[model samples]
Structure formats: C-alpha cells, structure tokens
Target: MAALLEYLPLILFFAVYKFVDIYWATGVLIVTSSIQLGYHHFAHGKIATRHWIFFAIALVLGGLTILFQDEQFIKWKATVIYAVLAVSLIISRYIFKKNLVEKALIGVLKSANEKGDTDAPLNIELPKHICEQLNLMWVAILAFIAGLNIYIAYNFSLDFWVNFKVFGLMGITFVAILITMAKIYKYLPEDQS
Candidate 1:
C-alpha cells in the first residue's frame, strides 16, 4: 500500500543491516525518521503528538548511543519510550481521569457529528463509565505490550528487534484495535441504525 511504501526507507534499512554495522542502521533510522517527522509537520499542519514524542525519544537515545558507542543505550531506548507512554497512559487514567487513546479515537466520531451526519454519531456512543473503563483497558494493554517489547529486545538479536519494531508492533497494534472496535461496537446506540 502507499502508506507502507512511505516507510520503505526505514524498512529497507532494517533489512539491509543484517550483515552491516549497527551504527549505520542507527544513523539511517535517525535520519529517516527525522525527515519523515519534518515532512509530516510541514504538510500536515501539525506533527502527530505520539509520534513526535517517539521521535524525540529516539533522537535523544540515538545521540547517546553515538556518543558512548554503547548498544545498550539504543536497546533501552525502546524500553524507555514504551515505559514512558505506558506510565503516561496509566497516570492519565488514574490521576487525571483522562483517556487519551479514546479521545483520539473519538475525534473521528466528533468529526462525523460535526459534519451533520445523522447516522455517523449514532455509530459510536457510550455511557461515561464505560468510556472510562475502556480507556483504562487500553492503558493496561499498552503497558503489557511495552513490557513485552522490552523482553523481546533484551533476549533477542538485532534482526529480530528490527523485525519486531516493524511487524510485531504493527501486528499487536492491529489486534488491539480490533479488540477495541469489538468493545465499542456493542455499545453503539440503537438510534445509530
């Protein structure tokens, strides 16, 4: 798909680096992600919030890796980013009483409602309590997945790490989205039909 192609450079770098040096691959990743971030910011009017955070963390970790020549820094980057996001999600749910994931998802529903689509708004609605519960569910899921990533990266090789970074993350996220969709679908208002 076109979306996949847009990330080809990153994918290819990961593929070609199996026998190549890690620094080269790391450099390419940093450069490519930075460029991609710039492209999004200039064309899309705003950098995606989560991705921007990911890139910033990657940038910092990449710099540390280069400076110290320690692969551990690069390896732990995944752990740190995942932990930060997981903690943020958990804190938002428990402390702030917010569901950031749901808010992002609801933007689509809100947009449909704003567009005066009678049927669209009905497709997604929930009691406030269910919304909060679902949000907490997502936070738990994210934390679990983050911990899983740490396990894989620490025990596995670089090739596996790269593959997991691409395919594994995508696969897990797709599964999560499906689960979320199933939960939301049941709660759709009868009027939406």
Candidate 2:
C-alpha cells in the first residue's frame, strides 16, 4: 500500500499519457499527488513537502506547455525540477550545514546508531564537512540524470521519454539506494547480536 502510493504519480501520469494528452497526464498527476499528500498528512502525520513542490512545478509547466502548444515546455519540466533540487541541495550544505540528503541519511544513521556496534563505524553520524562533500556528489548525480533526460527527449520520441521517466528512473534510483545500503552494510559492526 505504501509502496504503491510512492509510485502513484508516475503510474497516473503514464496511464493518462497513454489514453489522453500530455497536459491531461500532468494534471492527473498533480491531482493524485495532492490527494496523496493530504492523505499522508492526515493519516501519517507527515507532509511530503519536496514532492508537493515538484508537483506544483509540474502543474505550472504542464499548463504552460498546453497553453503554448509546444512540447518543449513539457520536456524542459524535468530539467527545471532536477536543476532546482540540485542547486537547493548544494546551497543547503553550504548555508545550513545540512542538506536534504543528509537529513534523510540521518534517519538511517540514527537507526544504525541504536542497533549496530562500533567495530567499524561508517560514521553515519556525518559531520558538516562530510555532508558538504556528499551534497556535491548528490548535486552532480542529479544534474547527470537531468542531462540524460534532456538528451533522450531531444533525440527520441515522447513514448521513450515517458518510459524512461518511470522504468529508467525507478531502476536507477533503486540501484543507487542499494549501493548506499551496501556501503552501510560494509561499515556495519561485527556484532550481529
């Protein structure tokens, strides 16, 4: 159920794209994301601010694309969102001593802190300096993904873009998460008990 919710936007967007227009697809995604956000807030006592912001941007860009009747606007939507996220991550590291990724990483670190031994610490606690360095890497990867989207969209067709939006992104993100988890595993303490 929770897993489905995470993928709902992409699924809704893809379905609408297949049956309707791109703008309609985007609109449906916005609506579904709003509902999902509201549900999370009321039921889980949490709000997905990042997703909400991205959805808002998608809505505006989708509307603009439809209004101008130019597919380029819609294509550029991914680029704009990715660039904004990357820049924000980089800035947060420098100005706030922590970025979005570090905050999220902390959640995992805290759990590891409570459970794992200190035989070989990954220092998942992550100092400010390390967070800054990580933010740089994160921003670069994000930009790379955005650039890949642009390259594919320009050279290929809409179908390819939509498929990449789901399968390609999901696959790549899964791999990245796995890599992170593996690294944590390596640094895990020897005490299994």
Give every collision pair in model 1: none
Q: What tens-digit string does per-residue lDDT give for candidate 2 at 40-88?
A: 8988788767867877887787778777877777787777887888888
Score candidate 2 by lDDT.
0.75
What TM-score, over all chains together, does every model reach?
Answer: 0.78, 0.79
Q: Residue 46 deviation, candidate 2, in Å?
A: 4.7
lDDT per residue for candidate 1 within 75-94, as digits (tens), equals 76666766787788778877
* lDDT (Cα) of model 1: 0.72
lDDT of each: 0.72, 0.75
